[model samples]
Target: MKLKQAVTGMAVLACMSTAAHAQSAGTFFFSTGWFHLAPQSSSDPLTVTSIGGSPTNITEANTGASLSSADTIGFTGGYFITDHIATEFVIGVPPTFDLEGSGSLEQFGKLGQAKQWSPTLLFKYYFNAPTASFRPYLGLGVSRVSFTDAKITNSNFEANVLHGPTSVSTDSSWVPVFNAGFTYAFDQHWFAGVSISYLPLSTTAKLNSTSTTVVGTLNIQSQTKIKLNPIVTYANVGYRF
Candidate 1:
């Protein structure tokens, strides 16, 4: 009858209102999805810093490296402080990148590989009202960047270029991140988002090699400074609590 119809209409309206205010204050959200990382990378010439525990600065000519693009799963967790402000923490399953030899080292092809880890925390400002279905945001943050499993994987390069058996190590540092993205709420609890971030980062790869001369085995220490300015893209689906 009329009473049942009225109740049903009111219920529908209530559902719509709930869905409309998905990004309101005091909301906590979590998302998981894909991250693609592309590095605008460059490196200083490879240098032999020391030989047999003695200082000998010898730089190679046209010997540098480039990093290959990588992809991995990414996650984001955030809390809304207000209708237009939020804080988020982002991380990814560390992706391994290939180091391709450049310039004078180009003939060696694959120089090495390493896994990169960068966990970031961002303070964001969202544009538009809380009730809107789509919102865009800009964020500023810092990342703790590190590397692991770095090594000279090419044996030919290790023997001919390094002139020995070589092992690798890398330095860690802190870098700033610039981020921007947008989210579209499907309802009160479900949403989809895409984001892009940039980081200006650099690290040094240190190499230790043992070479056998006519005399004996000599330990050689060498290093190269590399700039890895990467642009990262993320696409995810999320739920709000």
Candidate 2:
């Protein structure tokens, strides 16, 4: 009876070991969740003027634009090449961001809006055994931030400031991203995670204006450098396959 019981106990242990390995090494994962972008933003001195009009300089003390926080549905796909190393691609449904004038341009209010698509590629290293229920990871990545569909929203800004019809646009660029996160495994195939990432991003906003009046014509072109260094956060549930 003792010999039979020993054989059964070894069989159960072997099954448990297999279950633990199923979550790591050579696994593929997919996740979907909430992603939020909170911009800690600022801008350089703004110098603008209209042709045949007075020029105004908005200094560092007076140059400010506040970006509203935005959220969207986020998705990620990952492949584990080893027990501790993985590669991931993160993407999301584009989100619209509202820009409000602050400091010198505070009176303008709701200056404009733009749509953003930011996609990232990451290399991550997890710091725990494959069987552990919890793992913490650190990642380094690069992101492509593209801004499109920009529109000027404030009427007064156009009539009073630009003196006529105006067109606005933003430049797109790439930036580095740093990530720190943790994952909690619920079972062999199910897990949940939360991550925080920082991106130091910068862009330029350009405006072109033209007015035809009794006094011939007036035209103006202006550019403003904006720093949109943002902290991005994510909360997700995933399946390991």
Candidate 3:
């Protein structure tokens, strides 16, 4: 009977040790991964205004101002505030996307390029016991998406279409992000995970053109609304310390 009790006690001690090592307060984790951004992109009709003429609307289906998908490396870091709660920061190298024309402007090919940098902050709740090899998590977060390096890439469109120097700019905005994922622990310190997030992001793009026409330096303004509801996916290998 004493031998049996001793064996059970040792087993219990081992289980406790594993649980403690898995997740504890003050533990820090870092993850690096590959990410893909697939955007369900849509745009409003381009509204064009000329200094000498009335504003006119160009339909998106006619202009084809759509963006393409992007893939890049992503990173995340987290701090376990408790055994079941953590705060994480998600970031990565900014991804560049090519703006393309589809319907009427399809012949114009690539219209321009826009690069975005979005960093997110999340408060996550992990489920199951800390000793469990697999834990699913849910997170609510905020992401700030800013666009830069937006320029007109098609020389023909600028010279023939605009008849002058054209510049492009995008408006920045903040949005909410929703996340769901699971992490599998290979050991106490190493793990692998996959995450999925959705962000309902929207912005306005402005195109400014200066043309030396018979009417003088004609200042033309064009604006478009772009809706990018992107579903982002990540596969990561992580370590905890």
Candidate 4:
């Protein structure tokens, strides 16, 4: 009876130690990754006329611009609320874009490049033990994005007869965002993850008239609306403390 009791006590102690170790395994992490923004619906409206005395409405004519490939990078920190649940804060930079066209007669340019800073709050649930092998997890979060110091270049016009120059400037606004992601751990301190986030943003731009040495200065005012969706992918090396 005494031997049996001693063995039972040892077993209980070993189980407790294992649980404690797993609970305190990791408390901090950092990651860097590359991201891209998928195309979303965009519109531009302008009131101008062709030199042939024809009405030209950019938006009504579906003559706008498309964006190009962009790069994104971010950092994150997390704290465990329970043994299998944690909350994290993620911050990222605004992605830059270059404009393309669909072979329309409208004037096209780079439009501008935008940069954003976002702070997101997330909740994570770990389904398996935080081991040195594969550990998969899920997260959900809300983000706030800001755009700054955006610049535009290559804003010119091309037509059969009207060959001249034009320019545009813009201002940005705050947007609300949401994201979902999964992370795969290769070791106790390294992992990779991919996430997708949606942003509801719009802006307005000022159109400037240009001269082709004959048409002189043509004063014009126009408005543009832009909506975006960004998908982020990342691979990181982290440490547990």
Task: Name the best candidate (by TM-score).
Answer: 1
lDDT of 4: 0.56
Stretches of candidate 4 off by over 4 Å are 1-26, 44-60, 103-111, 129-133, 158-176, 200-219
How much lDDT does each candidate structure score? 0.93, 0.84, 0.85, 0.56
Per-residue C-alpha lDDT of model 2 across residues 119-190, encoded as one tens digit per residue:
999999998888888999999999999898887888887777666787888888989999999989887788
> What's the ranking of the predictions by lDDT, best on top?
1, 3, 2, 4
* lDDT (10s digit) by residue, model 3, range 112-221: 88898899999999998777889999999999999989888899877776567889888888999999999998877889999999999988988888889775787777
Error of 1 at 19 (Å): 3.4
- Residue-wise C-alpha lDDT for candidate 4, range 130-166, written one tens digit per residue: 4324445666666665555554444444222123344
Q: How displaced is residue 83 in candidate 3, in Å?
A: 2.1
**TM value for model 1:** 0.94
Best model per lDDT: 1
Residue-level lDDT of model 1, residues 51-137, one tens digit each, is 999999999999999999999999999999888889999999999999999998999999999999999999899998777789999
Query: Lowest lDDT 10-mer window, candidate 3?
Result: 52-61
Which runs of model 1 end up more than 4 angstroms from their true locations?
1-17
Residue 105 displacement (Å), model 2: 0.9
Model 2 C-alpha RMSD vs. true structure (Å) is 2.9
Q: What is the lDDT of candidate 2?
A: 0.84
